[model samples]
Each structure stands twice: as structure tokens, then as C-alpha cells.
Target: MARRSTPAKKKKTAPRGKTKTGKKPPKKPGGFKRLMLGAAMVAGAVSAIIAAASMLELDRAAHKAVNDLAKSSPAPDTSDRTDQPKQSDMDFSKGYDAPNRPGYMVERVPEGENPQNDTETIPEPRVNPAPKVAPLPSPEKGFGAGTELAWQKFATHVPDTGNAPVIAIIIDDAGIDKPRTERAAELPAPITLSFLPYATHLPEQVATARKRGHEIMLHMPMEPTSRVVDPGPHALLTSYDKVAILNEMSWMLDRFTGYVGVNNHMGSKFTADPERMAVVMQVMKARGLMFLDSRTSAKSVGYQEAQKFDVPAIERDVFLDDADDAAKISQMLDRVESVASKRGYAVAIGHPRDLTLEALNKWIPKMQAAGFVFVPATDIIRRNGVKVTG
Candidate 1:
């Protein structure tokens, strides 16, 4: 066993240097120390970067919060107040007051501040105040007095002719203006002018018509189904009580004088209401006036109501001048003539238009030549044996 043991291999060694033979070579640092130093340096750099990022984020968040608050809040009042700064006066170059400017109150960034994360709010401009208005004057009393006097003068001029089959031409809605009434007076035959009370030119129109020897009547306004209709300023309605009707009637009668009868101007609704019509008839009867129904509504109870009140009444048979055209008017004239020939007499209503007047001028002479007599409305009523209530 001793002979079989093998000799161990000897280890190799390097020779020493001659210049710095006594100095030994520097030993390398341990791997753990180098790794720890490298880690410390990296951590320091990372901390600096994180701090800078955090500061930037904080500033961005502050700016955003300020913009949001401004937008959510109510706008400041700038009208009439000089104490506050105007939108034009705001300095937006610094970005802080940019949000206060007319266009930048929502997201304006301050100068030197990054706009990528900045925000601001803007407000609307104030409007001017409205101007004050003045109040209107009160209406004057007895405004239609002159109109009544003109009518009275007309009534005094009624001729005392014997009763015959009179053909009355009651021209309604007169007294609108002096020129119109004066023109109406030029008719060859006498007419009954139903003048509207309290018209713009009531006094002069009625007086002029009366001076021309025309009979007069009151063209009283009454309510209709349409709310858009203007029944003049003083309209009679079903809603009015007896006192109101009487007062209105009296005022109307006092406004115009020579009216021998009363007629509806636009009494579609009033004529349909029996109770209201009764009141109107009763007032007419008391005033010793006759009643003429314009027949604005087919369902009108005007005739029945007048009879109930013992007032002389008649309804419009034909509106002679309904058509505005000359050809249509001529056709209507022929129809009127046919009716007159057959019935012996007929009551026709026409306006004061130039067309109507021209037609009348031509047709009247023809009728006279044909032996057709022209009579007043009263004469027609009396000749027909229609008893006068008054």
C-alpha cells in the first residue's frame, strides 16, 4: 500500500517585478461593494426625476381646479357698476387673468406655464337696461255729443207725404267720414242713413248727410261669434246686464239725433241670444224707434224679439251691393229689378262706394222710366199696414 501512493502535483507561482519589487499589486474591490455603490447612484437620479414630475403634476392640478371652479360659479354682474374690472381690461398675457378675459375664462394658461395641462374659464358680457315708458291719457266724456245733434236735425226734415208703397233704401254704416257722407248725400233718391255712433267723423258726416235731406238711423254694434271682429269701441254683448245695455243704448242715442230706427252693425252673436235681443228690442220700443235686422247671422232672432217687445221690425231682404265688381253689381241690379217687378216693392241695402253709386245712378233712372216709384222706408212700412209700436 505504501508503494502504490502517488506523489501530489506542485502548484505554479509567478516571479516578482524588479522596479517596485517590495510593493505588492493592489487587490480588486469586492463585488458586493461595487454593486451597492452603483445602486445608490441610480436611486439618487431616480429620486430627482420623480420630484420634478411631482411638482409639474401638482401645478397642473392647481390650474385645472381653478378653471373648473370659475366655470361652475355664477357670472359676476358688470352692468352699471364701475368698481369691477371689465373683460377688455383683463391682462391675459400672464395666463392667470386670461380666464377672466371675454374669450379665455375657460382654459387660458399663465405665461411660462405649460398649456398642455392648464385650463381657465371665460364669462359672457352684460347687457344694457331697458328704457322706461310713459302712461296713456284717459278718454274724454261725452265724446259723441256732436253726432247726436246732427241726427236730430235730420229727423226734423222728414217730409209729411201720404202713406204709399214706399221703397226704402236704408244705407247703413254711414258717418264714418265727412267726405264719404257728403258723397252719399248726392244720391238722386232720398235714403235712410244708419250712422255709426262715436265714429271718427260722426258729427260732420251726420250733419252733412242730414243737410242733404237723408233720413237717419243708429247703426248699433253687437257682438259676433268671431273674437277678431271689432264692434267699434262700444259693443253690446250678452254678457252685459240690463243696466249696462240701457246705459250703452242711452249713450248711443244721445250721440246721434234724427234716427227713426235702429239696426245691428254686427250682431251675429247678440241676435242669436234671445234674452239679449229682448233687452235690445225693449229699449228700442221705449225709445219709440223701429228695428231693422241686418241679418248678419241666419240664426238671428231679431225679428221675433222685436215683435215680442211690440216694436215695428223688418229684416234685410237683399244686400244689393254685396259684390265689389261692376259686372257682379250689374247682375245684382237686374236681380233687384226682377224682385221689385214681381213683389211690387222690395227693400234693398247698398253701400256708399263709387261702384254702387254709379250703378244706382244708371239703374235708378231706368226704374223711374219704367214707372217704378222711389219711396222712404217709413212710407213703405205704413203702406204695408205695418203698425208702428211707438
Candidate 2:
């Protein structure tokens, strides 16, 4: 028993595919090869991400290029649009060239932008605006020396009393204030009414004035000494060229008819310029129109130029409403009587203000009773020893 030894334990052995306990042995872990496979998958994913990012950058660049190109492109051509202005509409550089069309003196501006249908806003001319065109032909060239013109054809009739101190009371600035103008027209007969060409409904207004037995004249606007005082639309500025001057004159003259002559509206500065006055006198001669120099300026050469061109002209001797007061107007009327008494005739200018009209209403009768005759302005021109020729 002492030497009893257990049989030697033999190592247990399974078949080739079995474990010692009759099961297969566990598989060994794959090391480097598996790691390599995992690494490859990760690299493929990273490449896909980078490719997507590059595609996004390219798309952004393309979009930016397209936007820039669109920005650089020009606007679409609208030349075919009917609302656009034409190239030959006007020569805005020289001045506002009135449309060759006959109507009110409308300024030619771009369509739909504050169209000046009534009047033009003229700037203060600082220099001679006359273009270097040939001078107008001599007065004897166009209408022969003896053609009967408007001044004679349309002259108001007045009995020729030899040196009887005739008084011509001219109402300037007529047709603007319709009520006052109508009242003035009703005051007396043969009150020489100088109407502004820009007045509305000129034909009708003038017809009414003429029906009331008032003589008519065109109150041609000219440049004044003060820039603040506007001379209205299409004024005859000293800066206007001969062509422009003629065009403006044409527009004014064509407004209405049956006017005996024209007188300066507010020609303080224009009447003083001899050259401009000469040009105007030539027009007067051509139109067979008389010139009544308002004589707003002391140095006016309008009378002299009229004589040079053989235009029948007269000057204003007294202003009836210079002060706009009834007493002052009465005094001025007295002065007119004095002047008429001394010089055998006088031309007094007044406006259509109520005070002037009222004063005239009372004074005309007084003067009529005092043996002073009231005549049209043209009669006074004839009284000045200048023969009225057609």
C-alpha cells in the first residue's frame, strides 16, 4: 500500500479537429491583415468625403460666376417704346427751342416728366445768345416800301382833330385778370388794351375786348433790369440769337389778330440795347406794325432805332398807376393832361387794377367835359408827326 502509486496520468488527446474535452479549439485572432482591411475601409470613406467637399466648392464658384456675369450685363433695349423722346425733339443746348407745331408755347422736355404745357422757365441770360447768322435783309427788301400792314389795316378809328391835345390811355397787362380786364374794357371805348400773348383763351378774350370798342396791341415781353421780375414765357432776351428772337416774335404775333401794333411789356434792359432794338425795329417794319416804347429805362434807344428803320413809333409820357393809389393815379392823370396840353398830345400807360380803372372811370368823363379828347394809341402815333403808312 505504501508503494501504491496512481497510474501515470496520460495527457488527454482529441482527434485533429476536436479539443481535449471533445470540442473544437477556439480560432486565433487575425492581427495585421484585419487591421489592414479596416484601414482600407476608413480611407475609402475619407476619400468620398473629400470628393463631396470639392464638388460643393466647384458649385459655389460656378454660381458666383453666373451672378457676376448677370451683374455686368447691360439693361435691355427699350428703344422701341413709344413713350421715349425723339432725337429731334429739341435743341436743349442753345435754349428751349419751341416746337415747330402751332399751339401754346409748350416746352419740349422728355415725355411724362413735368411737361411745361403752359409756359417755359427761362434762365437769366448772362451773355449774347445770338448765333453768328447773316443779318436780316433791309426793310425795303421783303415787303416793298408801301405794303399796307397790320398797324394800318387794324388801326382804330379816331376823328383827326388838328392839334387838339388827344390823350391815349393804354391799358397794359390786359387779359390776365379776366374780371378786371372785362371791367376795364367796359369802362370806355378806344382804351388801347395791350394784351399779353400767353394769356389763356386769347381769341375769345380779345374778341370780347374788341366788341367793347377797345383797341388791341400785343404786349411783347422783354428782359428787365432785375432778374427777379420774370418777363413771362418766350420773352425776347438780350441773349437770344436773331433766329430765336424771330421765333419768339412769331409765336407771340401769331397768338391773335386785329392788333394795331406792339409795345414793350417790361423792356427796361432790352430797350437800352441799340443793336437788339435795331433788330426789333426791322421786325416791326416787316410786320407793318407800330412800336410803342414803354420807355421803362432812361437810356432806351427804342425810338431812335424805330426811326432808323422807318417804323412808326411813340413813347409813353406818363404812367397812370405807378403808385397803385387812386390819388396818385389822379395826379398822374393830371400830369398827363399837362403834358398833353403842352405837347398837344400824350401817351399814358396803365394797368387793369381796380384803382386805375376806377380813377380812369371818373377822370375820363372829367377830361371829356374839359374839352380833352380820348383817342386810341395809334392816333397818338399819328399825332407825333410820323405818317401812318400801311
Candidate 3:
């Protein structure tokens, strides 16, 4: 009891991890410190947003600068012939239809016959009746050796350009837009124009395009990978037997005159089927028409089949305006340049969009300056894997 009196009341100590109130201690800053941390976090978020907005504004400014530069650049258009009549003159000229031909000849009903009495008076077939047999042009003996069985009549005229890179730009999906298609035809000599057989005014439009120094190719509709991708009404399908596929192809091939070849509109599925494609290439060769493997699908065997069948064939190198941005289209043309540089020639396909047209308008001059020659699609084809020449 005498020693316990000296051992005074023990000094109380706080728990290691708890407050005096028996709760968890504040492990991190709190109160004024916590408020300061929250403020710092909010300020950082705002700074990040401002930086993003600034970056976006810089990108927009860069695009604007590019657009302005393109506009300011002078385009030397040698494509437009000095002798050619003005657009105003052409518009008022007597021949609105340049190569005026009886498009889809039809049997006229007797004028006096009553509609009820007469057989179902059919509206004229959209296309002219296809020729049952149009003999393929046999190769002339002049070119010798590898050139046998090749047809030059269908080939577009190419100047003796030596060994310069040749570029073929084919505008597909023509005939739907009369004005734009016609305008494209007038772009430059040797720009290939591929017309859709099902379009209503194909014959007239094709004639005009051909008259304007553009080479022609039939844009044949074919089955794609997905059922949702409707190529068109009479598209060639993998489901079709040889006879049916050939029949539909014949109709498309015979749609118009003066085409160098046929190219698929959307044949991702049909082109891969060797059986169907073999029939198509055989028919193509037999008809004196070359074939362009649109290369819509990576699995397509069209080029190989054409090689095996000795059918003149080439594959599309670039597709312009897959996105309708003018700058992007110009970039695709740059791809065309790379292809042409590598392979001695290249083939690019584009639609009649404003961007495509604009890009071409700017690019044609630049390409010419670069010493690349623009040729037709047929010029680059090969027979038996041998480059064909007339």
C-alpha cells in the first residue's frame, strides 16, 4: 500500500489505429487538407478538358490550312483539249446523244390494236436484246509469240510511252447520275468508265462517255458476302447454276457496245467460287472482252482463273472515295502512285462522288507532272500471265 501510493495514476495512451473516441483514425488528410485535395483533383480535370479542346481546335486549323493550300495550288489541266467545243456549245449541240444508236430495240405494238386485244403490251426491255453469239476476236499474227488470242479492238489506244508507270482510273457505278458521269468521262482521255447494266439510261450515257475518250467496262452486279448487301435486281448469285450464271452474265455483257471488259460491282462471294468464275472467264474470253477482278473480296479467285483460262485480266489496285473525303481520296490516288511505281501500272476504281471528282481534278495534273501516264484498264491485262500488246 505504501509503494502503490507512489505509482500514481497510469498515464492513458491512445489506441494504435483508433481515435480517443474508439473509431478508426483518419489515415489520410481530412478537413481542410481533404478539401484542398478535392480542389486539386477538380482543377486537374478542368486542365485536361482544356488541353483536349485545344488539341481539337489545332486539328481543325490544320485541316483548314490543307484545304486552303489545295485550292491555292494551280492545276495544269492538259486533259481538256483546246479544239474541243466549250461546255455551253456542247450543251446546245444537236447531238445530245453523241453516239446516237437505237438503244434497246423493241417490237412496237400495232397502232390500231386495242390494249385488251393485243398481247400484254410489255414496256420496252431496259436493255437491248443481247446477241446470242458475238464472235471473239482472234489474235492477229503481228505481235507474235505471247500475243496470240489477244484482242486489241477492245483495248484503249495507248501511246508509245516507253517504260513510264501507267495508271488506269475506272469510274464505276456510272449511268445513274447523267451529269456527273458525263463530267467524269470528260475528265481526261483514258479514264475508264464502267456502267451498270441495269441503269435506265445506260446506252445513251455509255455512248456519251465513249465519245468523250473514256474507255468502257461493264459493271456487272454479283452476290456479295452478306445477303443484306443487295447488288441489284439481276445480280449473279453463287446459288445459280452455270447455265443461269452464264445467262445473267450474258445479259450484263451485252448491255452496251464498246466496253473493253467487265468488272464486278459487288462479287465478294461469286468471284471466290471457282466453278462460277471459271464459267465467267470462259464466257469473257469467248466474247473478246477482258475481265477486271474488282478484288472486292480477299478470297476472290478471278485473277487466277483468268490467268488459267488465258483471259486478259487485271486487279483493282486502289479504291478512291471509299470514304468521301477529298483529302482521303487524294491519299488513295497516292496509293495508286505507289502501286503503279511498283508494278509498272495500276488500276484504281472510284464512284461519281463530288469528292472523287474534286480529288481527280486536282490529282490528274499532279500525276501528269510526276511522269506517270494514264492508260485504260485493258492496257495492263495479261494473257497466259504475259503482257498483251497489239
Q: Pick the candidate with the highest lDDT.
A: 2
Preferred candidate (TM-score higher): 1 or 2: 2
Q: What is the lDDT of every predicted structure here? A: 0.58, 0.69, 0.65
List candidate 3 stretches off by more than 4 Å: 1-151, 382-390
lDDT of 2 by residue, 1-390 (tens): 478778998996656765567766667658987899899999999999999999999979856744443343233233443432211223222221223311112112223432112112222331212111122223464567556667776777767665455788889888766777788888755789998887767799888888777789999888766554556777787775455566678789999998988898876777887866776776787677888887776667888888777777777777777566888888888888876665566678898887888888888888888878888877765554445553
Residue-wise C-alpha lDDT for candidate 3, range 1-390, written one tens digit per residue = 466455569888876876667866557765999899999999999999999999999979856743443343232232432432111111212122422211111112234522122112222322221111223334433434455342455566667566677788989877756677777887855788888776666778877876777788888877766543456656777766555565677677667777778888877777887877877776776666777887777678888888776666767767776666777877778777776665566678888777788778878888899898888775555312334454
On the 0 to 100 scale, the lDDT of residue 125 in model 3 is: 29
Decide which is better by lDDT, 2 or 3.
Answer: 2
Clashes of each: 16, 2, 0
**Backbone clash tally for model 3?**
0
**Error in Å for residue 54 of model 2:** 72
In angstroms, how far off is 165's CA in candidate 1?
6.4
> Which segments of model 2 are wrong by more than 4 Å?
1-146, 384-390
